[model samples]
Target: MIVLFIVLGGLLWLISLLLFAFSAWASYKLMRLLWGKIRRALLRPGTAQITSYEVFTPDPEDIHVQDTRPQIRLELDCERHGQRFQVSLGPLTCEELFPALDLPAHHIACWLSDEDWRQLLEKRWVTIACDWRLRKAILTSQIRNDRRLLLISFLSLSLFALTVTLSLLPH
Candidate 1:
């Protein structure tokens, strides 16, 4: 009976230790995942400093040079200081450029000079993409929360089993 009690106690201790270890591992994994998400959010395209520019459909009068097509054009315009420049955007595609432009639904398509156009595009793309990614991260966090809860429950159950086995052993 003494031997049985010792054995049972030892088993319980081992099981509890294992449960604690697993719980710690799960927590570490969760922390790493959160860190990765934060890093990605900070570093992904458009999240960092503005790097490029674009021009959507511009008014013919506003455009210094006119082209037959009305497409949106993206240009690298970081160096042009205050000078109004014009670039011909061949054609405007609402689906492809609207989200990138971050224009309001009620806003009308108007002409913007090359400089103003670049600034607007840089601001629009950064703002929209950041918002979209934040929403996506929130959804992913919700799912991960559920998984973490399940892992905790499993760990608790293992601990419970250890306690029960110890109690049932003969004195």
Candidate 2:
């Protein structure tokens, strides 16, 4: 019975180490894609038209805090070319747009920027040159606030140490 516990713990510890390694590799790749690949790309377009926009919020599991990231979808008008496209940027917070937010939230509608919305509304066409793949953004966010990940790392190390100590004990 004791041997089974030790073996299971050892396996989990090894798995956590592999997971940590993968996370590091993924983070490195995401940063490279976000900055290195698009260093010269323009973040904003000279002209953009906001035909429509909608804000979305998922059901909150707890009253204390929201669960899902807030998102907004914008349908842009391409008047000069005669085609329409949609662009979205979300899971935003006050820190992303204005001076700062008192608390950081994964979801903030439009970064609470009326001026930004006005800018989009004023223009008849819009373009985004430097937007990254959604996958990259998700990975970046995971790395930014990885509480569960850190916990797993610590647990893994402790398990490893415990397994070593157990093996050293008398049979």
Q: What lDDT score goes with residue 112 in model 2?
A: 47
Best by TM-score: 1
Q: In model 2, which range of ten residues has the least summed lDDT?
A: 130-139
Error of 2 at 77 (Å): 3.0
lDDT (0 to 1) per candidate? 0.48, 0.48
Which ranges of candidate 1 are over 4 A from the true structure? 44-100, 104-171
lDDT of 2 by residue, 141-166 (tens): 33323545555767998999999999
Q: How far is candidate 1 from the true structure (C-alpha RMSD, Å)?
A: 16.6
- Residue 27: error of model 2 in Å? 10
Please give each candidate's TM-score: 0.31, 0.30
